[model samples]
Structures are given as structure tokens and as C-alpha cells.
Target: MSTFGTLFRVTTYGESHCKSVGCIVDGVPPGMELTEADIQPQMTRRRPGQSALSTPRDEKDLVQIQSGTEYGVTLGTPIGMLVRNEDQRPKDYSEMDIYPRPSHADWTYLQKYGVKARSGGGRSSARETIGRVAAGAIAEKYLRLSHNIEIVAFVSSVGPIHLFDPEATPSSDPAFQSLLSTITREKVDSFLPVRCPDTVASGKMADLIAEYRDKKDSIGGTVTCVIRNVPAGLGEPCFDKIEAKLAHAMLSIPATKGFEVGSGFKGTEIPGSKHNDMFVPHPTKPLSLATATNYSGGIQGGITNGENIYFKVAFKSPATISIAQQTASYTGEPGTLEAKGRHDPSVVPRAIPIVEAMAALVVMDMVLQQQSREATREMLGRAARLVPELSRQEEKAAVEGVEKVLEAVEKA
Candidate 1:
């Protein structure tokens, strides 16, 4: 499904090495402030060649808002966006046409569609995520301005260099809550090259990636994402759970292999008595609900429960490696292949923005769906307020013999 969401829907288009890449974002509320300025930073963040950790391909990825806005405000129309592709090197992937790279989508894409783009990994490339990041910026803008919700993602692990202690409380104390609420993208971007928040671990991760890059091999890593200020009842029940949708989004990214939330697989080690979240009165908002423990990752019964929603995304090693490997050709002849292309040694750092973007898309869609419910309740309340308890009209009708029955019935 190239298109995503129901109300705040977005459909991404174009391919890697194509003329342009972008998306059309639909269902933006009218009069909301929007512009390319609000969306470009994310695109830039997701761009490669920002540092030594990523590929050398540097596409400016400047987003151009083609339509659906006037004077820096949304018009409630389909917002058309575009980013032209520069720095194309089709020659870099010419060998891939005959000798399919191992563990890549090239073989599968051909098997499924009978043909595939031989340049720059095509639709299967990480470049495909540009559209997602662009649309996600728009969704994130609305979410932040209207609801005060915030999303942040950072490199959590690169080959077992964990930045966070798994057993430690994700929310340490009131100070942690304060920081969680106040943490900004600026702080995250401050940790460039390897988006890990811990300087020591980040340095180690950077070294490891450098070692891998020097060896012409790729390594896998993980990203941790957090959603803050998510209100209760944001997710649809049953199959379309918020966590499930989040899993879908994370897995949709190129080279992602696994996903987990909260305590994740480790939570199983604890007893039920120890793992269950205890409901308590909110610390700041009296009479409101909260949890003493967030083992549930702020979600229960597939709905958000007014707590921090956090999860981890596991990325697989990049399939294309410069290391010579024995592989079969498209014609079934055995051969040695030297994969040549500008690719990341690790995707975690660059994937941070992509993770943030996908989270924004999911949360924005869920928020819009929840907003419809809020609107319905408000409309019903207004209708009830405008009517008498016995269905009496406020004013009498002028028609003869055929009077308004509601007022007459109430008067009687």
C-alpha cells in the first residue's frame, strides 16, 4: 500500500534515480500555517552524505510545495510536494542488471513484477523514503501545533552498543518527565554522525561504523523512538492497533528487520505481578489518569493511555557491500560479484528522521480519527443543548393547524 492513512492520507511517488521524488498530502485542515520551511529540515536530516557515517551521495532534497497552500496557510486541498533527484550515477549500478545482489529486493522485485529498475535500487532504495519524510513533516507540524504532541527518535544501538539501560525506568522521575516534554529536535540533531544521545556510546558507534565502512562491509543497528503527550483513546481497537500500525511503519523502512515496544522481548522474563502497569492519579493533572509503571508502553488494549509511547526498530545490514562474494547471475551462472554503489555503513543515524516521520504519520492519522469521534460527541452535545428534555422547540411555528408538535407536546 503506497498510500497511507485515512483522513490525513499521503501517497508517495517516483523512484530512486528518477527525475523527482515526493508525495501528495491530503486532508490538511484549512487555514493552518504551512510552508516548505517547516518541511525542509526533516528532508535535509534524512539526506545522505551529512557526515562520514552515511553514503557520499548528497542530494540537496530541498522540498518544493507545488500546491494546496496559499500565503503560508493550508487550503484543505491535496498538498503537492516535490524534490528533484540530483547526483544520479546509473553507471554505479550497471553491474547489478546482470548479477543480482544478494539479500536485496532486486531479485524479488523482478520475480514479482517481471522487471525492475537497474539503477540506484529504484523503488527499493532508501531514497524512496524521501516522500514519507516530507509528508510526515506536514503531519508532525499539525500534530505539534494543535495537540502539543512530540516525537523523537535516535540511534539506540549499533552492533550491541546500547545507549540506554534496558532495566532502567524509561521515565526516571519528574525531571525525566520534564525533559521528555521539553526535548527538542535541536537536541537530537546536536548528536550528529551517530544520533545516539550518549556521547560515549555514540563515539563508540561511530568508530564501529567507520571500521565497517573501511572494510567495505555493512552492519545492522537499532533506533529507539518515543511519542510524548499522546492522549488516551488514540488507537483503533482489534487489528489496527497503534502499536501494530507503528510496527508496520517501522518495518516499511528499507533494511528494517524487527520491531519491539516498551520492555519488548525482555518483558517476558518478569512475572505478571511485576510487569503490570498500575493506574494512579496523574501527578500533574489531578483527577486525571496515569500509570505508576509504563511497561505497557503507554498503550493498553491497543489504545493509547496518556503516557509516553516508546519502541525500538531493528535495521538489517545494508545488502549492497563492496566485499567480493560468490553469487549466481540472473541466468543461473555462478559468479563472483563486487557490489558497487554509494550506500550507508549503517542506517540507524539517517533512519532516525525516517522513524520520526513514520511515527508522525501514524499518530497524525490516529489523532484525526480520534478527532472525528470528538467532533461527533461535541455535535451530539450541542444538539442536546439546543433541544428541550421533552423535545420541545424554542419558538412557536407560524403554520395554521399544522403546529410544531415538539413545543405543543412540551406545553401540554
Candidate 2:
């Protein structure tokens, strides 16, 4: 049930402070070039102890392929990977062995599953995001190559600390691919704690984190993501709508409490006429269509209309603050507990890659679905145009492909 997607499905596993946590990618296209190196950067971005703002849990987060790949190429099978839980301090959470952490999933998890892991947050921890970011790297590659699509996500806010202009934000302006090529270990280290591109905001955010750290408190913020160059007409209508799928993906991430596409909540303030995206035929190209406004967020009638797709997500403050809070134990016995051990005072920096990954995952599924449907439609149209001359095999292939596309969409 934790899995998402249709063509390139991914199911995340493991828990915080477990032996390991990872993901299984099902339905990825074969012969795509991939390796641990391809996934390492994203994993590193999500790893802990990278900066003064984050948890002090220093982890290499090294990814190891367990199946479905050979010699760095996908083998048309389920790709299984594991990132070992190194630098873990299980004993730090011993106080909660019988008494669950307040405001965490301890009671709910036990109530639903009858048992819970005592160490750290177990599966509820943000540590689980390692697999998602890794898998999303691959999904991003597929989407880029297949559709010339690119996804960009950045931390737009920290608590009430907002990055004024995105272009002014240092990390906000770089093409992630280009940045990847020039990224050095030294550069990576210097950017850690908070990955704000704007040095001024970064310093301010750093100071704020230090203040919060001293106070043993936490803060929340928002992340903005953009998917560019997506072709018009992806995503099915009704239940399998593209926006619905994206909403599902965003909600799946830990601590994500709010989601809004282009002009989302703001749209509520505008009239329907003002909110509607008016079609504007391109002046230079007759075949191309655009919209004067992107209020629809590059989607209309549950399909992509080929504009920049943008959205924002709000993450609640990390619940695992060091400050003491009052709550009951598993038996509803009230007591005071102060969270200890390594934990991110704020997750904005680490969450950037995770959001990008989820966006990539959704876009990849949409692209594949679009390709299948278009291929089938083209074949059918050709056969209908050349009736009685269509080959038997062509007819059968189109039928099969259409059926597969239908099945996938239905499942989504």
C-alpha cells in the first residue's frame, strides 16, 4: 500500500533505526543506464547530520542494489535496493521502549499493527525518505529522457523565514543536472545544514536554527516544486486524474500537511473567469497552444496542457523536538517526555530532494501512460484509415498495448 505509480511503481520499506531502509522499484524500463552513482547524490541530500540545523545522525546512506540490475543497467525486473543504517544510536530511544514518544505514531502504530519498534521513530521516521529519493532519481532520469521533462524543487520557506526571490536564492536557480556535474564534496559540505542558494537567507536561517536548537524547539515551512517541459495531454480523466495522483504523492511524504498547485488557495479568492486559463494559440506556430494564465497549473480537465507545472507543499515542524512535552504512554498513563538523540530541528533542507523525487515519480508515471495511449491511438487510427489492409499482427499488437495501457490507468 505504500507503493506509488503504475508503469514504474515503487514501494518503500524499512524504518528509522532498523537494520536498513530502502525501496523496491517495479516496472522500470529495461536497458536504461543506472548505478549507485546515479542515485547517490539524491540519497546524500536526504541523509542526516549534514548541517547544524539537521539531526546529528551522521550516515553515509550508501545505496546497494540487491536485485533487478546488472552491470549498471536495468534488467526489466523489480529493482531492489538497501541502504544500511549506519551511525545509529538505538539506545538513545530506550526510554520509549515501554512509553511511546508524545505526538508520534507510537500509539497509533501499535493500535493498528499491535506492535511498534522502540528505537527512534521506527518506520515513521523521515529516515525512510532515503529510498524514495534514490528511487526518484531513477524516475527523474526516465522522465527526462523520455519526455524532455525536468523537475526542480527548492526550500522556499523555513518557519516564517521565507526566501524572498527564488532567483536570488543560490540553490534555487541552478539546473539540478548542471549543478550535479560541477558538485564537489567540498561544495556539498559548504552548502549543508540549510541548502538555501541565497547566502544571506542561508545565514539568517542558520542563525534561526541555532536559536531553535538552543531553545530545544522546532519549526515548519513550505517547499515549492516545478515540473517543466511536460508535453500536453498526459494523465487520464476522472479517477486517475494527474492532479489527483500528484496530490496523493505529496501527501504520502512524512510531515506534509498541506498541498497547493498553481493558484491553489489563492484561486479561491478570484472569480471563475479570472481563475480560468484562457487558451492562446501560439503566434509563431499554428500547431502549438498555450495559455495566458497558468492558474490551472499546466493541467485542464485532468490532463496536462504543456506548461510549467508548479506546486507547493507545507511540512509541519518535526515532531521530535528535544524540548519536553506532556503526553500519555501506550496505556494512556500521562507523563512528561523530552525527545533525545539525533533529530532534525527543521527538515526543509533535507526535504528538498524528497519533494523533487515525488514530483519525478508522478511525472514518470504520467509520461508512460501518455506514451502508451498515444501509441495505441495512432495504431488504431492508421488501421481504420487503411481498413482491410491492416496486418493481423499489427492489429493484435495494438490491442495488447491498448489493453495494457487501460489496465495501468485503471490501477492508478
Candidate 3:
């Protein structure tokens, strides 16, 4: 399960206390400008100890690209990126080897593998996500430069503090609709600590995190990610639907407990007639289909409908808490044990980049798949010309289209 994606694949390796944690990204398009600079910012955003509300462990989390590049450009090979675990304190987790922290992966990993890491939960550690963030940075760069696709994610909720009213009117007000259609990553990151876009909500979320941290407890939260400018028909109709893949990518992250996309569960409350996205002509393209209402969240029938794709990821509170708890040990003996380790009070802020990264990966894979499917469809359509069309002009036009398709495939 470490490897993900059909076309553009990423396989992550290493663990929290390992010498390094990194990934090998395959299927990257060649000649993209890629350096440590492009991959570092997301790593920094996802790094621990960024603020008082996060873990106290101060890790630089610097990424080093080992291969798949030539002169700062991608070589169209498996790109290998590494970020050394520079701030691991394995001693703090020594007790976890026997006690098995409640709600953590300790006991599960041990039970599944018949052995576990002496310190953190090895592959289950959040630190492993560094590779995902790094690889997703590459996918994001490619998507942005190639397709003008923009992925933005922010802290949407912390415990009970939500950024928007779930039952409130959505995308109806012209001003509010415009704001959502044109939001940027900068605006999301503008409010720190909690990373919620609303300043008032941000302050409360930050306060909640700090309050929980002081009590040695943790809080859960949600992140909303928006992908804009993705062309229509980027997803498969059935098993590989865009929302399904996004859910798969997001839930793969540690502490993620749930997922929902556009309209989400709230849409269930509305009547089908009202919940449906009415069709409208594209603003500029007369023949193109666009939706008057985007309750579909930019996707329909498991495929992107050329609108903004928005989804929410729910992250459980960091499992490694400092609170003393009574839980059963491996030998089935009940005992009180206190867990020790630098952990986030809430996972939302750091999860922002993780969400964006996973989204980017999903889109990149889907885009490649769409391209492949298009190529095949074009060739098949070209073959269909063998059947009688009854018109010289139509046959001539089909011939020209087939030639053009062949030329493009050769170039690829």
C-alpha cells in the first residue's frame, strides 16, 4: 500500500527514527524545472514545531533530491527525494514498546507485523508523510505549469469551530461565489496557527489547540481543499472516479478518519431537484457545458465537470498524547501509562499541505490517465472511418483528424 497511483506512482519508504524518510516518484514528465527549492516550502509548512500550538520538536525537515533530475530539470525517470530525520528522540518512545499507546498504531502494527519499530510506529508515523509532501510538490508544479491547475487547502475546522455554517446558503450570493471561485493559497495561509481563512475562526481554533496542548490532550479538525482550473472529464466513470481517488489519497494519511466531497453530507438534506447542478453554457464557449449551481463541487458522475473540485478531510487528534491513560498491554494486563513524544495538539494546520499534496497527486494521475484514454479513443475513432460514412467531405475530415492524431502520438 506504500505505492499509490496508476499512471503517476509514488512509493514512500523509511520511518520516523530511520536515517532518512523519502519516496520514489515514477511517471513524471520530463524537463520540468525541479530543485530542492520547489520541494522545501511544503516540507517547511508540514514540519513540526512551526508554532506554539504544534509539537515542540524542532525539525528542519530539509529535502534532498537524489535522482531523476539533470541540471535542475526532471529527467522523466523515477525521482528520488530524501529528508533526513534530524530531530528524532527515540528515547521518548521507549515506553511505547511495551505499553502500546492507546489509539496509536503501536499495538496494531505489532499485531499485524509480528514485530514493530522500537520507537515510533515505523511506517505509520506522520513523519512518513514528508515523502508524500515532497512528491506531491513535483506533481503540483507540473499541474500548475502544464494545465494551470491550482490546488489550495486550509484548516476548515478545529473540533467544534467551523469556518462556514453547514446549513447556510452556499454559492448563491454573487460576491461569496466569486470569492470561492477565485480563492488562492496565499489567502488560506494568511491566517496562521490554525490556518483557517476566517480571522475570527482562526483565533478561536488556535486558542483551542493551545488549551488542549496544556492539558496533554489533543483535538481533531478538518481541512478543505479546492482544485481549480482542472479541465472537464479528468476522472474515470466507474472505480477510478476523481472523488474516490481523492478519498483514497487523503485517507491514506495518518490520523485521517473521514472524507467527503462537494455538497457532501449536507447535500443529503436538500431535495434532489434542488441539490442537482443545473446545466448552463460555458461563459465563453457556446457549445461547452457548465453548471449554474456547483453543488456538485465541480465533479459529476465521478468525473470532473470543468468546475472547481472541493473536498474535506477529517483528521483525528494526534494519537500520541502525553495524557496518562489506563489501557491493556501486549500481555493483556491493564495498567496506567503516560505517553511521551513531541506531537501536535491538532493535526489540521500541518495537514493543509498534506491535503494539497494528495490532491495534486490524484489530479496528476487522473490527467495522465485521461491523456492516455484520449489517445486511444482518437485512434479508435480513426479506425471507425473504415465503416461507410456516405459523404466524401466527412471521410476527408476524418482522415485529416486521424493524421493529426497520429502525428501527436508520434511526438509523445
What lDDT does each candidate get?
0.88, 0.80, 0.88
Instruction: Point out the higher-scoring one by lDDT: 1 or 2.
Output: 1
Candidates 2 and 3 compared by lDDT, better number: 3
Where model 1 places Cα greater than 4 Å from the true spot, the runs are 165-182, 386-412
Clashes of each: 0, 4, 0
Give lDDT tens digits, candidate 3, residues 293-337. Answer: 888889888989998888889999888888889887788889888
Q: Across residues 33-152, which tens digit of lDDT does each residue of candidate 1 receive?
A: 988999999998999899988999979999999999999999999999999999888899888878999999889999989999979788889888999999999999989898889998
Using TM-score as the measure, name the better of candidate 1 and candidate 3.
1
Candidate 3 TM-score over all chains jointly: 0.91
TM-score for each of the candidates:
0.92, 0.86, 0.91
Q: Any runs in candidate 3 off by more than 4 Å, and if so which?
A: 169-176, 380-412
Per TM-score, the best of the predicted structures is 1
Better of 1 and 2 by TM-score: 1
How well is each residue in 1-412 modelled by candidate 2, as lDDT tens digits? 7788888799999888888989999988999999989888888877887767778888999999889888989999999989999888989887786577766787788888988887878788888888889889999888878777777666667876776543332222345323432433344336556765557767788788778877998888787777887888888889988888888999889889999887777677778876777889966667888887677778888888887787888988888887878877767778888877877778887888898899888888888888899999999998798875657778898999999999999999
